[model samples]
Structure formats: C-alpha cells, structure tokens
Target: MKSLVLCTFLLISLAGCAQNNKKEMNQNYSTEEQEVINVTDHLTELMIAKDLKGLNNLLDKDFTLTHITGYLQPKAEWLKEIETESMKYYSFKPVNRKIEINENKAEVIQQNILDARIWGTRNHWHLQQIFQLEKRNDDWVILSSVASIF
Candidate 1:
C-alpha cells in the first residue's frame, strides 16, 4: 500500500544517486590523467627553454634524476651542475615526444638531442628519456626519470 510505494520510490532515488556518483568518479579520473600529461609536457618545454625557475617550481624536493651515462644525481646536485656549467652553452631539443597518463601517474617518452658549444668545440649526443610523474596536491611533479643513449 502506501508504505510499499514509498519504499520503491526511495530505492529508485538511491539507485539514481549511485549512478551519478559513478559517472562523477570516472570524470575525475579522466581529468587527473589529462592534468598529469599536460604538466609533464610543460616540463619538457621548460627544459628546452632552460627555464630553471620554472623547473624548480615543477620539481619535487625528493626528485631523482638519472642520466643516460648511468649517473644518478639528487635535485641539488643536478641544479648545481647546470649552474656551474652555464646553461647557455648547450641546448636540449626533444623530438618524438609521447605521453601516457594513468590514474595519478604519468609517463613521458621523448627523443632528445643536445647541441653544445664549449671551449669553441661542438658536442652532440642523442638521448631517449622517460620521465615518471606523480600527482601531488592536485599538481603534477616528476618523481623519477631515466634516460638512455640513442
């Protein structure tokens, strides 16, 4: 009678709410993935521009950087190396860049070639770099990276 009708109505309302919540959850995940990819791409652009300040802002304090030459350096050490050498002497050009985002994590793969003029001598090297990024506090930051000589 009246009780049965009320119970049915309540069940239908609850079911609709659950469906809406599930849709919202999916949208949130998609948005997070897009954010991670966009941030990583921005990082590469910063690198090409040699924007140290931008780089600092995007990188986490505990960031780990690994080179194609098997050298692993902490954040401070990496910044110091660039500072001592002068970033003007070299340029990093990344080509064939690709990004993949999943959940709160992202991976950026790119082929890079360095053009350096030091002591009036030119040095060049090809590189394949993979950047692993994580989302923290709604911002994407690089967690770790590894590169290989190409």
Candidate 2:
C-alpha cells in the first residue's frame, strides 16, 4: 500500500534525524568536557608556577582545599604555601581522571601521583583529588577541592 510505503519512509527519515541529533549531542559533550579539563590543567599550571593572581582569579571566594592529613586550607593559606614555595610541586602523573558536568556545575575526580615538597619534606604521593567548579559569569571557577592520599 502507498500509505505503508510512506510510513516506512517517514520512519527511516526520523531515525536518521535522531542519529544525527545524538551525534551532535555527543560532540557537544566532548567539547564541554575538554573545556573542563583545560580549566583544571590551567589551575595546576598556575599552582606550579606560583601564579597567585591567576589562582585568585580562578578560585571562588569561598574556596577551600582539604588536605589528606584532615587539615583544611583556606584559599589564602594555600596561596601562601605556593608563594613561599613551601609546598612545591615538581611533577604530577594523572592515573585516572574523570569529569562530570551538570549544567553550570562540574566535578572532576582525579587519581594522580605527585612529586612534591611539603613544608621541608620531599615525597611522591598517590593522591585522589576531587574538585568542584561552577560557571561564574561564563567562566568556570574552582569552588572547592578535597584530596586524600592513597
């Protein structure tokens, strides 16, 4: 029947459109995910370079960094460490990195081994870090972070 033939054509067309839409969505997600990763990478670079102003611009006002030793370092204290070179990071190797983005908020979970000098001691530590970020005025800013040693 002509009606059946037309219905089949319509269904096929709709399926193709659906597949295209899905592919576009996946591409969009990939782009957004890469943006999040870039932000995180830039933050790390700022820390490594002891760029206080850059870090300040990227960190939210209420930012907090919870250390593996159960001590909470507020933004000022963490920046001070970087400025004084007391907590110097030499290198980091990210083992497992996962990111989740929900609308204007994102969370990045990373498992990494870092070589750093904390206070006066130098060591390589395997750490799990969770970072929370929010889009503020079209720019992603880090809101908080928690790190645990493994």
Candidate 3:
C-alpha cells in the first residue's frame, strides 16, 4: 500500500511539470520582462555548458545559491563545484515561470525539470528557483537564487 501510494504521488507531481526540451514559456511578455528572462535563460545555458567565466559576468560579486536542502552556497564555492563537476547540469525544461520588477530589482520564479548529477546523485530534479536580480549599468545581473522543489 505504501509503495502504491508513493508511486501515485510521484506520477501526479511529474504530470504538472515539463518533460521536454522546449525552453520558451509565454510569448506575450513585456519588453522589460523579456530582458530579464534573457538573462536567466543565458544563466541556464552557462550552467549546463560549464562556462564559469561567462556565468560570472552575469552574477553579482555577493551572489549566492540556496539549495533545496537550505544550504547557502556562496558564489565562489558554487563555481568551484561546477568546475570540479560535483554539481553538473545537463539540460533544463522550464514548465512555468514569472517575473516581477520594481525599480531596478527583479524577482523571477521558474520551475523546470532539470537533468543533473549533484553530489553523486543523478536525477531529473523538479527544480524551482526564486532568482533575485539587480540592474546595474543597464544590465540585469543575478544577485542570488533560492532553490526549492516545484
């Protein structure tokens, strides 16, 4: 009974999220919102491609990545993990997303089925990240990311 219940729960959860490689979500986004989306999309690409330098250009100096386990990983350490492949991202399928901007700050919530090997566990994680970004010199740069399950 427990096994059947667990399987049913898992299936229901996966049904709500994207399982394909089609990345784009909504087409009627405002121009400002689209700019913010572009930044985050580039971020995902950089992560999967393991381009640390390019990723650095898009993040703030005091950037942080908060994992689902509530571990607050500093940017330097996270980059090191990516460099060493302790955290390796393969691909992302964004199912749902939203962006809100106030003045020069933007908050983006994105849910994706991400294929990755993290800390030796490889799975297609139903990942959701609340990313904080700030506009500096007319460019949107990620300040932090708080991750959770979809």
lDDT of every model, 2 decimals: 0.69, 0.85, 0.92
Best by TM-score: 3
Question: Could you report the Cα RMSD, in angstroms, for every candidate shown?
Answer: 16.7, 13.3, 7.4
Q: Per-residue lDDT for 123 in model 3?
A: 97
Candidate 2 — which residues are off by over 4 angstroms? 1-29
- TM-score leaderboard ranking: 3, 2, 1
Candidate 1 local lDDT, 1-150, one digit each (tens): 999999999999999987776456335445566566557657657765667788788888888788765789787777665555543335665455566777778887766676754334466767677888877777888887787877
Query: What TM-score fits each model?
Result: 0.62, 0.77, 0.84
Candidate 2's displacement at residue 84, Å, is: 1.0
For model 2, the local distance difference test gives 0.85
Ranking by lDDT: 3, 2, 1
Report the candidate with higher lDDT, 1 versus 3. Answer: 3
Model 2 residue 91 lDDT score? 80
Put down candidate 3 lDDT per residue, 1-150, tens digits, no spaces.
999999999997776543322433656688899999889989999999999999999999999999999999999999999999999999987778889999999999998899999999999999999999999999999999999997
